[model samples]
Target: MSGLAALCFLLLQTGACGFEILGWFFRGKSLTHEDITERAILNTTVQVCRALALAEGKDFTFPPQPFTAESVAVACGASKSSKSFCKAISLIQRKNWNVDLFRFYSSRHHFDDETFIEGRKIITEGLSAVKASNKRENFEAAREKLGNILHPLQDFYSHSNWVEMGNNLPNPNLIRAGTSIGNIAGKYNVTVCLDEIEKRNA
Candidate 1:
Protein backbone atom coordinates (compact mmCIF):
# COMPACT_ATOMS: atom_id res chain seq x y z
CA MET A 1 0.00 0.00 0.00
CA SER A 2 1.10 3.57 -0.57
CA GLY A 3 2.14 5.65 2.42
CA LEU A 4 -1.03 7.75 2.11
CA ALA A 5 -3.24 4.68 1.96
CA ALA A 6 -1.58 3.25 5.08
CA LEU A 7 -2.05 6.55 6.86
CA CYS A 8 -5.71 6.72 5.87
CA PHE A 9 -6.27 3.20 7.16
CA LEU A 10 -4.61 4.08 10.44
CA LEU A 11 -6.74 7.19 10.83
CA LEU A 12 -9.88 5.21 10.10
CA GLN A 13 -8.97 2.63 12.73
CA THR A 14 -8.44 5.36 15.31
CA GLY A 15 -11.60 7.32 14.32
CA ALA A 16 -9.34 10.30 13.58
CA CYS A 17 -10.99 10.70 10.15
CA GLY A 18 -14.44 11.13 11.70
CA PHE A 19 -15.84 14.57 10.91
CA GLU A 20 -13.41 15.42 8.13
CA ILE A 21 -14.35 12.32 6.19
CA LEU A 22 -18.00 12.02 7.22
CA GLY A 23 -19.10 15.64 7.45
CA TRP A 24 -20.89 15.68 4.11
CA PHE A 25 -22.98 12.72 5.20
CA PHE A 26 -24.28 14.71 8.20
CA ARG A 27 -24.72 17.93 6.27
CA GLY A 28 -21.32 19.09 7.50
CA LYS A 29 -22.55 19.12 11.12
CA SER A 30 -20.50 17.14 13.59
CA LEU A 31 -23.04 16.98 16.40
CA THR A 32 -21.67 15.14 19.38
CA HIS A 33 -23.91 12.83 21.44
CA GLU A 34 -24.30 15.58 24.04
CA ASP A 35 -25.33 18.13 21.42
CA ILE A 36 -28.07 15.96 20.00
CA THR A 37 -29.31 14.92 23.43
CA GLU A 38 -29.48 18.50 24.65
CA ARG A 39 -31.35 19.58 21.54
CA ALA A 40 -33.82 16.75 21.88
CA ILE A 41 -34.44 17.60 25.51
CA LEU A 42 -34.96 21.25 24.76
CA ASN A 43 -37.31 20.55 21.88
CA THR A 44 -39.37 18.11 23.87
CA THR A 45 -39.54 20.46 26.81
CA VAL A 46 -40.73 23.26 24.58
CA GLN A 47 -43.40 21.08 23.07
CA VAL A 48 -44.66 19.99 26.46
CA CYS A 49 -44.66 23.53 27.80
CA ARG A 50 -46.65 24.67 24.81
CA ALA A 51 -49.19 21.95 25.36
CA LEU A 52 -49.53 22.83 29.01
CA ALA A 53 -49.96 26.51 28.23
CA LEU A 54 -52.62 25.79 25.67
CA ALA A 55 -54.51 23.60 28.08
CA GLU A 56 -54.36 26.27 30.78
CA GLY A 57 -55.27 29.14 28.43
CA LYS A 58 -51.89 30.85 28.70
CA ASP A 59 -49.29 31.96 26.18
CA PHE A 60 -46.31 29.70 25.66
CA THR A 61 -43.17 31.68 25.08
CA PHE A 62 -40.21 29.85 23.66
CA PRO A 63 -36.94 30.13 25.54
CA PRO A 64 -35.19 31.48 22.43
CA GLN A 65 -32.57 29.92 20.19
CA PRO A 66 -29.22 28.42 21.29
CA PHE A 67 -31.21 26.89 24.08
CA THR A 68 -29.46 25.81 27.25
CA ALA A 69 -30.70 24.14 30.40
CA GLU A 70 -30.78 27.41 32.31
CA SER A 71 -32.82 29.19 29.66
CA VAL A 72 -35.25 26.38 29.33
CA ALA A 73 -35.59 26.11 33.08
CA VAL A 74 -36.39 29.80 33.45
CA ALA A 75 -38.97 29.73 30.68
CA CYS A 76 -40.58 26.62 32.10
CA GLY A 77 -40.55 27.98 35.66
CA ALA A 78 -38.13 25.36 36.95
CA SER A 79 -34.82 25.71 38.70
CA LYS A 80 -31.80 25.46 36.42
CA SER A 81 -30.13 23.30 39.00
CA SER A 82 -33.10 20.97 39.24
CA LYS A 83 -32.00 17.40 39.42
CA SER A 84 -34.49 16.72 36.68
CA PHE A 85 -32.86 19.05 34.21
CA CYS A 86 -29.33 20.36 34.70
CA LYS A 87 -28.16 17.45 36.81
CA ALA A 88 -29.65 15.09 34.26
CA ILE A 89 -27.62 16.78 31.55
CA SER A 90 -24.46 16.26 33.54
CA LEU A 91 -25.24 12.59 34.00
CA ILE A 92 -26.05 12.11 30.34
CA GLN A 93 -22.76 13.74 29.33
CA ARG A 94 -20.88 11.49 31.72
CA LYS A 95 -22.15 8.41 29.90
CA ASN A 96 -19.67 9.20 27.15
CA TRP A 97 -16.81 8.67 29.61
CA ASN A 98 -18.02 7.30 32.94
CA VAL A 99 -20.02 4.24 32.05
CA ASP A 100 -17.90 1.11 31.66
CA LEU A 101 -14.81 3.24 32.14
CA PHE A 102 -11.61 1.27 31.50
CA ARG A 103 -13.64 -1.46 29.85
CA PHE A 104 -14.27 -2.01 26.17
CA TYR A 105 -16.94 0.25 24.74
CA SER A 106 -20.11 -1.72 25.12
CA SER A 107 -21.98 -2.42 21.91
CA ARG A 108 -25.22 -1.61 23.68
CA HIS A 109 -23.91 1.80 24.72
CA HIS A 110 -23.22 3.20 21.25
CA PHE A 111 -25.56 0.99 19.18
CA ASP A 112 -22.35 -0.45 17.74
CA ASP A 113 -21.43 -4.12 17.14
CA GLU A 114 -25.00 -4.68 15.84
CA THR A 115 -26.34 -5.16 19.33
CA PHE A 116 -29.61 -3.43 18.55
CA ILE A 117 -31.75 -5.87 20.51
CA GLU A 118 -29.62 -5.57 23.62
CA GLY A 119 -29.34 -1.83 23.24
CA ARG A 120 -33.09 -1.44 23.00
CA LYS A 121 -33.48 -3.43 26.17
CA ILE A 122 -31.08 -1.11 27.93
CA ILE A 123 -33.16 1.89 26.91
CA THR A 124 -36.50 0.31 27.79
CA GLU A 125 -35.30 -0.95 31.14
CA GLY A 126 -33.71 2.35 31.97
CA LEU A 127 -36.88 4.20 31.13
CA SER A 128 -38.84 1.90 33.37
CA ALA A 129 -36.42 2.47 36.19
CA VAL A 130 -36.65 6.20 35.70
CA LYS A 131 -40.42 6.09 35.85
CA ALA A 132 -40.35 3.94 38.95
CA SER A 133 -37.97 6.27 40.71
CA ASN A 134 -40.00 9.33 39.77
CA LYS A 135 -43.15 7.65 41.03
CA ARG A 136 -41.41 7.31 44.37
CA GLU A 137 -40.34 10.97 44.24
CA ASN A 138 -36.70 10.06 43.88
CA PHE A 139 -35.76 12.65 41.31
CA GLU A 140 -32.05 12.04 41.67
CA ALA A 141 -32.32 8.37 40.86
CA ALA A 142 -34.73 9.13 38.05
CA ARG A 143 -32.29 11.58 36.52
CA GLU A 144 -29.51 9.03 36.61
CA LYS A 145 -31.64 6.44 34.91
CA LEU A 146 -32.79 8.94 32.32
CA GLY A 147 -29.21 9.94 31.60
CA ASN A 148 -28.12 6.35 31.12
CA ILE A 149 -30.85 5.76 28.54
CA LEU A 150 -30.42 9.01 26.65
CA HIS A 151 -26.77 8.26 25.91
CA PRO A 152 -27.48 4.98 24.15
CA LEU A 153 -30.64 6.33 22.54
CA GLN A 154 -28.78 9.25 20.99
CA ASP A 155 -25.94 6.99 19.90
CA PHE A 156 -28.40 4.97 17.83
CA TYR A 157 -28.90 7.85 15.43
CA SER A 158 -25.22 8.81 15.35
CA HIS A 159 -24.01 5.26 14.70
CA SER A 160 -26.87 3.91 12.58
CA ASN A 161 -27.84 4.72 9.00
CA TRP A 162 -31.39 5.64 9.97
CA VAL A 163 -31.22 8.89 8.06
CA GLU A 164 -29.35 7.31 5.14
CA MET A 165 -32.02 4.62 5.06
CA GLY A 166 -34.50 7.35 4.04
CA ASN A 167 -35.94 7.74 7.50
CA ASN A 168 -37.32 11.25 7.72
CA LEU A 169 -38.39 10.75 11.34
CA PRO A 170 -37.22 8.78 14.32
CA ASN A 171 -38.08 5.10 14.64
CA PRO A 172 -40.91 5.35 17.16
CA ASN A 173 -40.75 1.68 17.98
CA LEU A 174 -37.42 2.17 19.67
CA ILE A 175 -39.17 3.61 22.70
CA ARG A 176 -42.06 1.20 22.71
CA ALA A 177 -41.56 -2.23 24.15
CA GLY A 178 -42.59 -5.45 22.35
CA THR A 179 -42.38 -3.89 18.92
CA SER A 180 -39.83 -4.52 16.22
CA ILE A 181 -37.27 -1.74 15.84
CA GLY A 182 -36.97 -2.66 12.17
CA ASN A 183 -34.38 -4.72 10.37
CA ILE A 184 -30.80 -3.68 11.10
CA ALA A 185 -27.87 -4.20 8.76
CA GLY A 186 -25.39 -6.79 9.89
CA LYS A 187 -21.81 -5.89 10.78
CA TYR A 188 -20.44 -6.83 7.35
CA ASN A 189 -22.91 -4.75 5.39
CA VAL A 190 -21.46 -1.77 3.51
CA THR A 191 -23.99 0.83 4.53
CA VAL A 192 -21.67 3.75 3.82
CA CYS A 193 -19.65 4.67 0.78
CA LEU A 194 -16.12 3.81 1.88
CA ASP A 195 -14.58 4.75 -1.45
CA GLU A 196 -16.21 8.16 -1.38
CA ILE A 197 -15.00 8.70 2.18
CA GLU A 198 -11.47 7.66 1.20
CA LYS A 199 -11.49 9.86 -1.89
CA ARG A 200 -12.69 12.84 0.09
CA ASN A 201 -10.07 12.30 2.75
CA ALA A 202 -7.36 11.75 0.17
Candidate 2:
Protein backbone atom coordinates (compact mmCIF):
# COMPACT_ATOMS: atom_id res chain seq x y z
CA MET A 1 0.00 0.00 0.00
CA SER A 2 2.84 2.44 0.86
CA GLY A 3 4.60 1.68 -2.44
CA LEU A 4 1.45 2.53 -4.45
CA ALA A 5 1.03 5.83 -2.56
CA ALA A 6 4.66 6.84 -3.32
CA LEU A 7 4.21 6.01 -7.01
CA CYS A 8 1.06 8.15 -7.20
CA PHE A 9 2.80 11.14 -5.58
CA LEU A 10 5.67 10.86 -8.07
CA LEU A 11 3.30 10.87 -11.00
CA LEU A 12 1.48 13.98 -9.72
CA GLN A 13 4.76 15.82 -9.18
CA THR A 14 5.96 14.90 -12.68
CA GLY A 15 2.73 16.12 -14.21
CA ALA A 16 3.01 19.46 -12.38
CA CYS A 17 6.54 19.92 -13.57
CA GLY A 18 5.59 19.17 -17.15
CA PHE A 19 2.76 21.69 -17.05
CA GLU A 20 5.08 24.35 -15.69
CA ILE A 21 7.61 23.75 -18.45
CA LEU A 22 4.95 23.92 -21.13
CA GLY A 23 3.70 27.19 -19.71
CA TRP A 24 7.18 28.69 -19.82
CA PHE A 25 7.72 27.53 -23.39
CA PHE A 26 4.53 29.16 -24.66
CA ARG A 27 5.13 32.32 -22.67
CA GLY A 28 8.59 32.83 -24.05
CA LYS A 29 7.92 32.00 -27.67
CA SER A 30 4.40 33.08 -28.58
CA LEU A 31 3.34 36.56 -29.64
CA THR A 32 -0.04 37.86 -28.58
CA HIS A 33 -2.39 39.49 -31.11
CA GLU A 34 -1.90 42.83 -29.42
CA ASP A 35 1.85 42.53 -29.83
CA ILE A 36 1.51 41.86 -33.55
CA THR A 37 -0.96 44.73 -34.00
CA GLU A 38 1.15 47.26 -32.15
CA ARG A 39 4.32 46.24 -33.96
CA ALA A 40 2.68 46.44 -37.38
CA ILE A 41 1.08 49.80 -36.66
CA LEU A 42 4.22 51.32 -35.25
CA ASN A 43 6.42 50.17 -38.11
CA THR A 44 3.99 51.29 -40.80
CA THR A 45 3.34 54.62 -39.12
CA VAL A 46 7.01 55.49 -38.92
CA GLN A 47 7.59 54.59 -42.53
CA VAL A 48 4.54 56.50 -43.75
CA CYS A 49 5.45 59.62 -41.79
CA ARG A 50 8.95 59.60 -43.16
CA ALA A 51 7.64 59.22 -46.68
CA LEU A 52 5.17 62.08 -46.18
CA ALA A 53 7.78 64.39 -44.75
CA LEU A 54 10.22 63.74 -47.56
CA ALA A 55 7.49 64.33 -50.09
CA GLU A 56 6.68 67.65 -48.50
CA GLY A 57 10.33 68.78 -48.33
CA LYS A 58 10.17 68.82 -44.55
CA ASP A 59 12.67 67.33 -42.13
CA PHE A 60 11.74 63.86 -41.01
CA THR A 61 10.83 63.64 -37.35
CA PHE A 62 9.63 60.85 -35.09
CA PRO A 63 6.25 60.83 -33.39
CA PRO A 64 4.78 63.76 -35.23
CA GLN A 65 2.29 65.47 -32.96
CA PRO A 66 -1.40 64.54 -33.30
CA PHE A 67 -0.77 61.66 -35.67
CA THR A 68 -3.83 59.51 -36.24
CA ALA A 69 -5.31 57.26 -38.88
CA GLU A 70 -7.89 59.80 -39.92
CA SER A 71 -5.24 62.49 -40.24
CA VAL A 72 -3.07 60.22 -42.36
CA ALA A 73 -5.96 59.29 -44.57
CA VAL A 74 -6.95 62.89 -45.12
CA ALA A 75 -3.41 63.86 -45.97
CA CYS A 76 -3.13 61.12 -48.54
CA GLY A 77 -6.55 61.62 -50.00
CA ALA A 78 -6.20 65.33 -50.70
CA SER A 79 -7.50 66.09 -54.18
CA LYS A 80 -5.21 69.05 -54.81
CA SER A 81 -2.08 66.94 -54.44
CA SER A 82 -0.15 65.24 -57.22
CA LYS A 83 -1.42 61.78 -58.06
CA SER A 84 1.77 60.20 -56.78
CA PHE A 85 1.59 61.87 -53.39
CA CYS A 86 -2.04 60.99 -53.09
CA LYS A 87 -1.21 57.44 -54.04
CA ALA A 88 1.51 57.19 -51.37
CA ILE A 89 -0.86 58.40 -48.73
CA SER A 90 -3.49 55.99 -49.97
CA LEU A 91 -1.11 53.04 -49.97
CA ILE A 92 0.15 53.71 -46.44
CA GLN A 93 -3.35 54.14 -45.15
CA ARG A 94 -4.51 50.92 -46.80
CA LYS A 95 -1.54 48.83 -45.64
CA ASN A 96 -1.75 49.90 -42.01
CA TRP A 97 -5.51 49.60 -41.96
CA ASN A 98 -5.28 46.08 -43.32
CA VAL A 99 -2.66 45.07 -40.77
CA ASP A 100 -4.63 46.55 -37.90
CA LEU A 101 -7.78 44.69 -38.84
CA PHE A 102 -5.84 41.51 -39.45
CA ARG A 103 -4.43 41.61 -35.92
CA PHE A 104 -7.86 42.31 -34.44
CA TYR A 105 -9.47 39.27 -36.09
CA SER A 106 -6.43 37.05 -35.58
CA SER A 107 -6.72 37.56 -31.84
CA ARG A 108 -10.04 35.73 -31.79
CA HIS A 109 -9.82 32.83 -34.24
CA HIS A 110 -7.73 30.56 -36.40
CA PHE A 111 -6.85 31.17 -40.07
CA ASP A 112 -4.79 29.32 -42.64
CA ASP A 113 -2.00 30.33 -45.03
CA GLU A 114 -4.10 29.75 -48.13
CA THR A 115 -6.57 32.29 -46.82
CA PHE A 116 -4.01 35.04 -46.39
CA ILE A 117 -2.33 34.29 -49.70
CA GLU A 118 -5.67 34.29 -51.44
CA GLY A 119 -6.63 37.53 -49.78
CA ARG A 120 -3.45 39.15 -51.02
CA LYS A 121 -4.21 37.97 -54.50
CA ILE A 122 -7.66 39.47 -54.27
CA ILE A 123 -6.27 42.79 -53.14
CA THR A 124 -3.91 42.84 -56.12
CA GLU A 125 -6.73 42.05 -58.44
CA GLY A 126 -8.85 44.78 -56.94
CA LEU A 127 -6.04 47.26 -57.41
CA SER A 128 -5.90 46.39 -61.07
CA ALA A 129 -9.64 46.80 -61.43
CA VAL A 130 -9.62 50.24 -59.82
CA LYS A 131 -6.83 51.66 -61.94
CA ALA A 132 -9.22 52.33 -64.82
CA SER A 133 -11.97 53.89 -62.77
CA ASN A 134 -12.39 57.60 -62.03
CA LYS A 135 -9.31 58.40 -59.95
CA ARG A 136 -10.97 59.41 -56.68
CA GLU A 137 -13.72 56.83 -56.88
CA ASN A 138 -11.26 54.15 -57.90
CA PHE A 139 -8.98 54.72 -54.93
CA GLU A 140 -11.88 54.84 -52.52
CA ALA A 141 -13.18 51.54 -53.88
CA ALA A 142 -9.73 50.04 -53.61
CA ARG A 143 -9.47 51.12 -50.00
CA GLU A 144 -12.81 49.53 -49.24
CA LYS A 145 -11.79 46.32 -50.95
CA LEU A 146 -8.50 46.24 -49.03
CA GLY A 147 -10.45 46.45 -45.81
CA ASN A 148 -12.43 43.43 -46.88
CA ILE A 149 -9.33 41.38 -47.67
CA LEU A 150 -7.81 42.18 -44.26
CA HIS A 151 -10.76 40.70 -42.43
CA PRO A 152 -9.48 37.14 -42.64
CA LEU A 153 -5.93 38.15 -41.74
CA GLN A 154 -7.11 39.30 -38.34
CA ASP A 155 -8.49 35.84 -37.56
CA PHE A 156 -5.46 34.14 -39.09
CA TYR A 157 -3.06 35.55 -36.55
CA SER A 158 -4.73 33.51 -33.82
CA HIS A 159 -3.90 30.25 -35.49
CA SER A 160 -0.94 28.03 -34.62
CA ASN A 161 0.53 28.90 -38.01
CA TRP A 162 0.68 32.66 -37.48
CA VAL A 163 4.41 32.78 -37.06
CA GLU A 164 4.90 30.54 -40.03
CA MET A 165 2.69 32.84 -42.13
CA GLY A 166 4.76 35.86 -41.23
CA ASN A 167 7.93 33.96 -42.03
CA ASN A 168 6.58 33.03 -45.45
CA LEU A 169 5.93 36.66 -46.50
CA PRO A 170 7.83 37.95 -49.52
CA ASN A 171 10.42 39.83 -47.46
CA PRO A 172 11.87 43.35 -47.80
CA ASN A 173 11.54 43.57 -51.55
CA LEU A 174 7.82 44.04 -51.12
CA ILE A 175 8.54 46.92 -48.76
CA ARG A 176 10.79 48.45 -51.38
CA ALA A 177 8.09 47.98 -53.99
CA GLY A 178 5.60 49.74 -51.77
CA THR A 179 7.99 52.63 -51.26
CA SER A 180 8.86 52.97 -54.93
CA ILE A 181 5.25 52.76 -56.00
CA GLY A 182 4.32 55.43 -53.49
CA ASN A 183 7.06 57.71 -54.70
CA ILE A 184 6.12 57.32 -58.34
CA ALA A 185 2.46 57.85 -57.61
CA GLY A 186 3.14 60.88 -55.44
CA LYS A 187 5.93 62.43 -57.56
CA TYR A 188 3.67 64.75 -59.55
CA ASN A 189 2.15 66.14 -56.37
CA VAL A 190 5.25 66.14 -54.18
CA THR A 191 9.00 65.53 -54.40
CA VAL A 192 9.13 62.33 -52.36
CA CYS A 193 10.95 60.65 -55.20
CA LEU A 194 13.98 62.95 -54.87
CA ASP A 195 15.68 60.91 -52.16
CA GLU A 196 14.90 57.62 -53.83
CA ILE A 197 16.19 58.94 -57.15
CA GLU A 198 19.36 60.29 -55.54
CA LYS A 199 19.95 56.92 -53.93
CA ARG A 200 19.60 55.22 -57.31
CA ASN A 201 21.90 57.80 -58.85
CA ALA A 202 24.56 57.20 -56.25
Report the number of the highest-TM-score candidate.
1
Regions of candidate 2 where Cα sits further than 4 Å from its true position: 1-46, 64-67, 70-120, 130-137, 160-202
lDDT of each residue in 24-54, candidate 2, tens digit only: 2356544433233333443454555567679
Query: What is the per-residue lDDT of model 1 for residues 1-202, given as tens digits with 9 covering 90 to 100?
Result: 3221221122222221122212223455465444554566666666666777889999878888987788888777786445567766666555533443432367887678778988888877887787788789997787666667765665666677765565655666666678899956544666558898999899
TM-score of 2: 0.35
Window of ten residues with lowest summed lDDT in model 1: 8-17
Whole-model Cα lDDT per candidate? 0.61, 0.38
The parts of candidate 1 lying over 4 Å away from their true place are 1-29, 79-85, 100-104, 186-202
Each candidate structure's TM-score, on Cα atoms with residue i matched to residue i, is 0.69, 0.35
Clashes of each: 0, 9
